[model samples]
Target: MSSVWAKKVNSSKSGFILSTRASLSRASIVGGALGFPRIRLPTKYLGMPLYKGPKKSFLWDDLTSRIAARMEGGEAKVLSPGGRITILKSILTSMPLYLLHVIVPPKSVMCRIERLFNKFLWSAKGQRRIHWECWEDLCYPVEEGVLGMRRLQDLVNAARMEGGGGS
Candidate 1:
């Protein structure tokens, strides 16, 4: 967040801040004089939403939407089951890891994310395949159950545990 302000506010090339000492008109003048746009809060920085107040479920929708977009693409349909599993375990899961540590996404957002992953994992050639087993069964170790990918709920619990553990 500071990095954005550093470039826009501190540098002579641009400017920022809707400050107390200075009104919006003054800030606009400064930015206009420097030829830069004014930045507002609740903006995205490094792919995660930056905002004040509660971490609402809707805020995490971008993470789900991105996954949904990936799943909706033509390329995902060509991958084999094993290939899909590998992508799920690697790319899909990793995308939300950083944000999970920062905010505990509400149940709806997590469900949407899991639903997208499950759909991607089971679908074949753009056709929806019937799921033979519960999603949880596929996520555990082979000996205990099955092995595929970790659930978003597990990741959330982990993030909560990690955040609470620092004290």
Candidate 2:
């Protein structure tokens, strides 16, 4: 009999209601009853965008920024080429795969991301370097003696084909 009942809904905290159609203002429902603030659209949930509008390139800008932020410290001088390839294949490239699975990014956006990966693979911090090998060649199967780095464009095409859309 020593337990206390903490049954307050904490009217100070804000809440969000994600609805596909803004026909009804449910914000008022909770605002009046619970004193919670109403959230606006174009917000994110668990780091993924939550808008239902047309799929535009700008919609995914946050994704590329996140990728770059993760690989910000150019490891060219710290890790060997093999290490970089392993990290890129296992981590950096895989970061967007989850989002890619749900949303097919525009080819132009994919190209920009691919270029960022290429530059990181070949260049050092604050300096440019030649891509001794093009990305397509690098993406060759590992059995063919090259590192198997899948290109971003190839991923978009694969997703499209998988979803019944032609190349």
Estimate, for each residue in 4-76, the C-alpha lDDT of model 2 and write its tens digit. Answer: 8889776565566646564556657756776776666666666666666665777678889888786676554
Candidate 2 worst ten-residue window by lDDT: 158-167
Q: How accurate is candidate 2 locally (lDDT)?
A: 0.73
Number of clashing residue pairs in every model? 0, 0
CA displacement after TM-score superposition, residue 83 of candidate 1 (Å) = 1.3
TM-score of 2: 0.69
| CA lDDT of each prediction against the hidden true structure | 0.75, 0.73
Error of 1 at 101 (Å): 1.9
Residue 102, candidate 1: C-alpha displacement in angstroms: 1.9
Please list the residue runs of candidate 2 whose C-alpha ends up more than 4 Å from where it truly belongs after superposition: 1-27, 30-36, 74-76, 153-167
**TM-score to true structure, per model:** 0.69, 0.69
RMSD per model, one decimal: 6.6, 4.5
Candidate 1 per-residue lDDT over residues 1-167, each given as its tens digit: 35554433545443354544567788778877877766665667667776666767766777888878877788787999998988888998898999887766677787778777888888899999987776666777767857657877778778777442211
Candidate 2 RMSD computed on C-alpha atoms after optimal superposition onto the true structure: 4.5
